[model samples]
Target: MRIALSSYRSKPHSGGQGIYVRHLSRELAALGHDVTVFSGPPYPELDDARLVAGRATDRATGPASRQTSSAKRAGATASIEPMSIEPTSIERASVEPPNPGRLRLEKLASLDLYNDDDPFRHPDPRELRDRIDVVEYAGMLSGSFPEPRTFGMRLAREMRSRSREFDVLHDNQTLAPGLLDIARGGLPVVTTIHHPISADRRLEIEAATNPWRKYTKWRWYSFVPMQARVARASSRIITVSETSRDDIVREFGVDPERISIIPVGVDVETFTPDAGVAKNAPGIAVETSAPGVDVETFWPDGSARHRVPGRLTTITSANVPLKGLSVLIDALAFLPQDAWRELVVVGTPNRAVETQLEALGLSPRVRFVSGISDDDLAGLLASAAVHVVPSLYEGFSLPAVEAMACGTPVVATRVGALPQLVHGTDGETSAVTGSAGRVPAAHGGSAGPRAHATGEADTSADADGSDAGILVEPGDAHALAGGIVSLLESEETRTRFGRVGRRRAVTTYSWRAVAEATAAVYTEEIARC
Candidate 1:
């Protein structure tokens, strides 16, 4: 089957979209189908249809053709263990390489106004040669996100004249009217909405202090209504979590039957347990700068048999209010000064975060990293004391799963998919009602945490009622602090959670499983088309 995957922007180092496109395409190709990924600026570093490095005119190519010699295609079952904090791999079951699938990426050009090197960029007048280019610029000037709509237009134009080169069109959340145009030309379109942009808009608007800020937030998310319309019109939709599916039904008014619930996966290959971190010294991990380049990070681990003490890690593609970075900062402030030594954020730090850190005298403790290599990220997760996801909302929290895959326990807000991904105490999660519901602060050298509801396990990864991590009420700084403090204080609890989390991550969320399920969607959609 020939699959054409579309994404407006895929930045592999940071965003989930990039990671989604890269890994899913790879696994799909490994299943012996042909995949051609069409993407705009901040292009994806795909293992499937990958962008050619530093080439003006290199043809897109897939790994199977370049790498596979013989053997039938392997089945998409079992764990995709070890993750690079975001994505990684697992060993494929040795089987015949059926059909020998191929995956390659085709680049799509865009003005790229939001490039970090320069934001709100001024394009050359001559560059605005096409009507589409002018429209993209006009949208940006009006304070609206123009990438999705413009990129869809560009994609439609690219495919307009080409004889149906694909069996199905897989759209990665770029809900645009142009998709309707493509559908008119006889291509089955399958849309994946991680969560609605409306959710983000609501959070930002509510967080805004002034009328002007709220108005700006409204303007920025102006495309959301259009997205909802497109989603309603869409024949088939894919979402990551039950919460997301529910939101789509309530927010977009789309039929529940049109939506399929497929959870996001973690790469077990890049994010595995830290076996190499020698316990020669307490709270020490052999960090690597590159291959054969070792950098050592030492923290005071009193009884932590697994992780560095006071090293908390979190990842966010963007520094938005919805991510709850502010709450995480507040939580840190609530902690005793000696409780935590450092924080490692796996994303860029903006002015807002910097200002908050400075105001709280935490300027010297927090370390922000962007454009980190996969290995480095995995190593960092493995060494960290606790991985935190303090988001007020998440369609699906990828970082939490990735951290779990790295054998790192997570302390996340009890919202979105965190409850499903990270099992709290008592087999299933129960929301916090009041102060009594909050997780109590546990010291760093405490005993085992939570009950072990071990029974006959099911296929749904870590079905045993062992707690993977503690889930706190959303937007509560004190609760966040308590959860983190609890894990930090007890290595026995951390070790248990880490193992259980790993089991859950591996058995439940694997790229191979995701690709196979996605392919099934494509097949069903194409049949309808």
Candidate 2:
């Protein structure tokens, strides 16, 4: 199959879009298909993603030069070779995108207004040569996110000359108005919305205290209406979790039949357990540098990777409010000093979070690591006493899946996909079936009933609680703190959850499986068209 994949901004190191694009394209190519990715700034990094478009591009320098924010690209240092295709190398109509079993990347030039180099930059009069550029500039001036809508317009224009060039078009959450135009051009279309943007707008607006901030959030998410319209009209829709699926049905009013659930996967090879580094005890290190153990085992030939005792960690692609970084900090404050020692966040620094840490006197105990490799992250998870997903919502968390693959037990909120991914069951029943309280550490412990918000009950738990990891109510710092404290206080329970989680991640969320399912969707949509 010849698949044309599209995305707006893809930060290779941190964000979900880049990770999804890279891994999925690689896996699809491995399955004997030709995949050409049409992406905006900060293009994805792929082994064979060197696809050249027959047409000219706006930015010839590619990912590095197009980057807008230094913070967004804090750890995004890997560089791709300059695009070697010259102007008029090939006409738009005459194209050959590698063989059936390869992947290529094509860069789509964008106005790039929100670049950190000069945020909300004023476009030179000469730079606004096209209508798309003008629209992008005007949207930025209005404090509204215009990338999705503008990127779609650009993509629609690019596809005008060759609509039948590919078997199907797979859009990566860029639900701009132009997608309807693409589908009308006789191309099979599939849009994968991780979650409803409406939820983001609501959460950000609610999180804001200032009325001006609330108004700005409302203005920023104004594009969501167009997204909902496009989502409703698309031939097929894909989402990561049932939570997101439900939200899309309710929030966007898209028919449930139009949506298909295809969860994301982790690289099992990169995220495996390290037996050399001993797992830290609840609040202390177990001694990795003692006796015959080599120090190199603890520290690979990489950058600084200090293994903190009693390490509690979480990952966020961006330090946004919906991710619940503040909630995590609040939960940490609820614990005693000895209950949990240090926190390690895997993302660029945020000033708001830093200020919160300073106010709570957790400045010294918390550390943020960025730009690390998958191997480094796997090792870190293996060394952690507990991994946490304290987000207010999630649409299938890759970080949680990766941690589980690394055999690290997780403590996550009972919202979105966290419950299903941590619960060792499918999307529906896993979260509700588990007991709320701690799993007994004693061998052959009796089970309890299903738990409620303000009350407790008994259910049949996996004596080992291996059926799932610990889950707490969303936005409740007290419940989150109790869940973490319970895991830290018992090594037996943590070990069981970690073992079960690892098994679930390895067996359930295979990249091959995900690619196969996605390809099946492509085949069905193509046939329908």
Candidate 3:
């Protein structure tokens, strides 16, 4: 079977979209399917598969290609073309590379010349007047997010012309207007929403201080309109977790029956534990270049586990607000420290969040890293005793799971599908809640942290249950600090949680299992069609 996967931006390090495209395409190809990814700029590198670059597309390409051809005709044998050898034979040369900048333009036109029967190709208008309105462009002009809409429109154009070449169109979260048109055009379409963008929008709205800021955040998320549209049109909707599935149903008003909970799997081949490190350390490492900061710090003892490190060497990624860096910072205040620890966050720092960190008097204890290598990250996680994931909500906490996979204990919030992913035997979980409606905080190091429910019966936070790791109130810095201290102070609990978390992650969240489940959904949908 041949499949075409679509997404707007797919830079490997950008985030989930890149990760999803890379792994899913690999898994699908490994299963003996021919997968061709039709993406825009920063196209994915589908290693080991026949990943044909789609039509070289952009506004300037058409004119650029035409200009290149005209230039070539005027001076045939005088000058050599920079982009490619001017069509070798005079008869074969109709279009020439206009200029280096316009090579993409000619390439778009050259697509059909090289591959005639490749039906999974988008249309390249023959005449300039034949072009149609790009709703995506219009949406962008209106201050609504536009990539998804544009990508969807392009996808629909391809599906209508080349629907016979592919078995189905698998959309990677670009819920665009044309997706429904493609589906209604009789091609089977399936979509995977890693989670909803609406969740981000909601968080941004809450974070906004004024109406103008709120309106701007809302405008930036204008893509939600397209997502909602494509999500409803998809024949089968796949998401990373039950938490996400429920969120989509509630947020998008989609029927629960239409959604399938297929968790995204990690590539264990590239994510195994390193055996060199003995004990992991957490501390702060300040930057000399950063404004208003002096020396780096390290805290070897868990006394101020979340503090800045003077001699400490560690790396963390904290671009995600849900990752709970703020709570971690708050926890730092509870520890006894005088700049003895260093923590290097391997990503962009949220200056706003950083201001709060500085106000906590921890500005000297943190280091921010950008463009870190995978080996460095893996080595860092491998050496660390603990990797903290202070998220308020998570569909499937990858950082926590990845840390465990690297043999490190994770201190994560008891929210979303985290408990299901982290806890085993369900004994510790059920004991806390009992039959009654009240869930008591498990208390200090000896008592274990409490499992306060988040007003949900199924979640680990259920005021009525017990679970692995500490269950704390969402966005509560104090409770978050207490939970981190409970685990940090006890090596036994950390080891126990690490082992159990690794076991669960491997047994349930492996990509092989996820792909098999996802394939089954594709099969079922095709059968229905």
Output the number of the TM-score-best candidate. Answer: 2
What lDDT tens digits, residue by residue, belong to model 3 across residues 1-529? 6676777655444455655675576556656665656664433333322111111211111111111110010111112232222432111111212221111100111122112144223435432222323443344446666566665666677677788877777788878777788878777788888788888788877878899989988997977866776676677887766567778888887787887777666544333464223224453343432477765323244223232212222223335455566666676686557423545554556677678776876766666644333333444454555666667667666556566666566655666666555543233332112111112222321223445544211222323322335555566666655655566566676566656655655655565566556667777777778
Candidate 2 error regions (>4 Å): 49-99, 275-308, 426-450, 454-461
Candidate 3: list runs displaced more than 4 Å. 49-138, 275-323, 338-340, 424-450, 453-468
lDDT tens digits by residue: candidate 2, 300-417: 4232233345778788777888888888888899888998867777775577887888788777777666545454567667777889888888877888888887778888776777
Off by over 4 Å in 1: 48-99, 275-306, 424-464
* Model 1 / residue 2 / CA error / Å: 0.6
Give the TM-score comparing model 1 with the true structure, all chains together: 0.80
Give per-model TM-scores. Answer: 0.80, 0.82, 0.71
Candidate order by decreasing TM-score: 2, 1, 3
Cα error, residue 167 of model 1, in Å, equals: 0.5
Score residue 401 of candidate 2 by CA lDDT: 84
